[model samples]
Target: MNIMKRFLKYTALTVMILIIWVAAIFISMDKGWWHTPFTQDKMPNEFIASVQEELQNEFVGTMAIALFKGGKLAEESFYSNDKPADRNTVFQVASLSKFVSAIGVMKLVEDGKLNLDAPVSRYLTRWRLPHSDFDNTKVTVRRLLSHTAGLTDGLGYAGFKNPKDVQSLEASLNKAIDADPGSDGRILIGVEPGSEWRYSGGGFTVLQLMVEEVSGQSFDSYMQSEIFEPLQMHSSFYQWDENFQDRLCDFYETDGSKAAQRYYTAQAASALYTSLADLEKLFHLFDEDNVNQKPVSPEFQKLMWQVEAETLGTPIYGLGTFLYTELENGGFVIGHDGKNNPPINTAFRYNPVAKDGIIMLTTGSTNFATRIASDWVFLQTGKVDALLFTMQQGKMIQIMAIGSFFILILVASIAFVRRTGK
Candidate 1:
């Protein structure tokens, strides 16, 4: 008699608890206590799996990827766990910093503190390139940002020791250009600016100089204050500052084996550390319509992607960013790629048209081999998740709705019975 009574009482209590849960859910959902969602209605699955396989086969290092569509996070993937490359892992973003740095300079332009057409020599009291009778005359902040300054690419990973190489910017700028005067006529005219586009790391370095001179802040400090902090890019940094060492993953070669060094990393050209999550915030700026409101005006961010030049009748590059159009679908995208060292290869690309983008971060032993891996990540983005995210999202919503609905009814019935009878 005692055991039967105990069992009945416990079962009643359990049922009552479940009924309350369901009632609360139904009430909350119906009363607008819960947010109504606009269903995504689409997902792509086959493409996602293929992308993962491609990444495993091609890129030999740890990797993470995320895709956003219509201004919402659509998909994310991680390939390894020892280093555990995730949205929060920061990779040295290399020349991508040029795009970021340029945004700061352009913001200054918008504020009327700097003129794009003004000769950079006007601001530099610390050092000035000897005005070549021809070459240096055309150099201006605008040309430099657009890589039209005619300055040749100088150091790759070969030039710097680490981010702390304390050499004055002037010393680095004085390195000789390999191109002869007038070798490229448009860039050679010592007349005025806005001539032609040439890929110049030296040009970006010049912009860094300009930012320092005008802001009255060190390059790293200025970027932190103006760009990274504002964007909440907590994982991004310019130099290998001591504080960031722990967050920094060891870079690798292509073999997925041993580590690589800082010199092999793209320092000025490619020396930036950032996580995938932060990179998404940076790329989402390209969206004219944004879910996050603090971003710069879409018009201005779009200006970053605008083609700044055409060479040999084809667009070579845009302002501080690479320009590429997909041939199969004619989709247009703009972004950048880098590996701090070849072993730790990284690439980031975003389609402004599709409002879709991806980033791959890897660390390993061989630089060249890592690039082969990097290419696979890029290919995976357009190939895989592009098609699979839709199916997965739809399935998720259906499961949640059915589960929620059942719980709502059971809880509501219990609540009504308790109020009426007890």
Candidate 2:
């Protein structure tokens, strides 16, 4: 009985310690204890130097960065190997394609060719979402843009090394020809529409089909004519052009090895090629005062900023872009980040009210651009954004290790109690 009592006491102690440890971690994260606060007074040169220092690490092969202040380019730089990289250096901007694709959809809406609330099936004749248990009619363009659509194909397209291997849009839709493993490649409604927030690249691919059918042009051609050309984003394209070869930066792996160049048929979801100079033009789209040649009307742009979906009690997504962090003035920092396998990461974030933002693109480094962008937000706002929390793999691993230690202690105590009782 005495041995059993001792075991219970040890077990209780272990449980208490585990609970306390978890509480501490949550508290620390809430307080932003892991982050070093950035002061607004810091000089741009200092920030540049810090970023340059980080770039010296082996994980990064090339990076293009720009800082915007008062809706104007304050500073910009390009870092790379012996290759010639400059403001015109083009990058395959992974999921940032979604931001531009969303704009294309809204342009169609502005033209009265598409309706946000209408059934997406109304727009597409090339393909249809596979039949499922859910109400397919409820799957609307707005829900798909906001990722609240019922589609369950959580696709992340893996571009092909050879252009010949690229699947037709309809064929790829039937089975994501190069999606990441574990994702259901077949595009279909899996849940009740407007039920919850779920990230689905497959949803955007459907929008691509809608754009092509309604515009009576290829997705790339439609985006170029309706969006990129009007913005004077001369170097941005949904599909690769032979003319861009000289400007395209080679992608690389995390281990500093070169990765094969890839091509994509899922242009809306994963195939935007852009330059820093061109992306700067995109940043101005959020600037309400710069209305000379806006892509969408102020009213539609405002609609895009309005919250559409949330995760973990925080409103994290707006119409087609990410609602990153809220400002004290009740405005939000908005942008998007993109990641592709074999190490390419890109991020762009800005506070529209403050007119301050960061644009970062990297090759041979996974999530490095996002971390830096998150840090910039933390410095400006003193609050950690949702993306920062997702990047805390190291902290999570430490917590898991500590919890495992406590569990082992409890197990050992139970063994001791049993042996003594015997």
Candidate 3:
């Protein structure tokens, strides 16, 4: 009886301690205890210096950063590993391509070539979504844009080394070489559409096909003519062109070794080569004041940023973009980030209301751009966003350690009680 009492007391004490420790972590994170302080009075030069210092400390190689204030370029900087890199140096922005593709889809909607609420199957003739238990009619363009089409294929394209090996858009959609060979491998509805949010690169591939079918042109060609030409993003391309060979930034592994450039058949989902200079033009697409010949109508642009899905009551994603956080005044900090194997990371974020934003692209660093962008958000808003939590490696390690220790203590206490009672 004495032994049982002792064991129970100790177990109770351990539980209380663990609870306090976890609570402390949540408190510190909520309060932005790990964030760097910034003030409005800080000069642009000072802010730039701080960012440069971070890049050096993180050991990033070949980076380009641009700052936007009041919807205009406030500052820009470039760093190189060995060869010269500048604003014109093109980089393969992985999933960021989806955001651009969303814009293309919206453009078609505005031009009466497509409809957002219409079933995606209505727009495609070349390929259809694979059969699934869920009602296919619910898989609309709007749902696809928001990743609520019930697609279970969480595909991250492992781009091909040889351009010739790239599958046709229809073939790639049928069976992505990199995807798992199970039910989750193919693009099929796993849940009722609009019931939940699931990231699906395959969903965007369907949009690519729809664009081709509706526009009567190839995906790359349609994007070039309708989106890139209007935006004057001359350096942007969905397909490789020999003209860009000399200007493309060489891909690098995290260890500073050169990585071969990869090709992707999923052009709308994973293949967009763009430069910082061109990205600046793309940034203007969000400027409400620049109303001359907009790619998407103002009404549609407003719809694009509106929350389309939530995770546990927190608005996570809008149509084709991420809603990082909402400001007190109801405006949202919106943008997209992209990552690819062989170590490339890119982040672009702006608060549409604050009219301030940051764009960072890096090679030879894993998620370095996103980490820096999270810091920038804290500096601007005095609050941490959701993305920061995803990147908190140190905090995660600490929590995992505490969890393991708690489990061990519970197991030992159970054994002690059982042995004592026996």
Point to the candidate with the largest TM-score: 2
In order of appearance, the predictions have TM-scores of: 0.67, 0.90, 0.88
Ranking by TM-score: 2, 3, 1
Per lDDT, what order, best first? 2, 3, 1
RMSD of each: 22.6, 3.4, 3.8
Poorest 10 consecutive residues by lDDT, candidate 3? 35-44
Candidate models: Cα lDDT each: 0.57, 0.85, 0.83
Residues 288-398, candidate 3: write the lDDT tens digits.
Answer: 888646777778777888999987577878889988878888868988898887678899898888788988888888888888787788778777776886667477568
Q: In model 1, state the lDDT of residue 103.
A: 75
Per-residue lDDT over 46-149 for candidate 1, one digit per residue giving the tens place of the 0 to 100 score: 33455566555454566666666655677777666266566776676556667777777777777678887778888777767555556564677777777776
The most accurate candidate by lDDT is 2
lDDT score, candidate 2, position 257: 79
Q: Which ten residues in a row have the lowest lDDT in candidate 2?
A: 37-46
| Prediction 1 global C-alpha lDDT | 0.57
Candidate 1 to truth, TM:
0.67
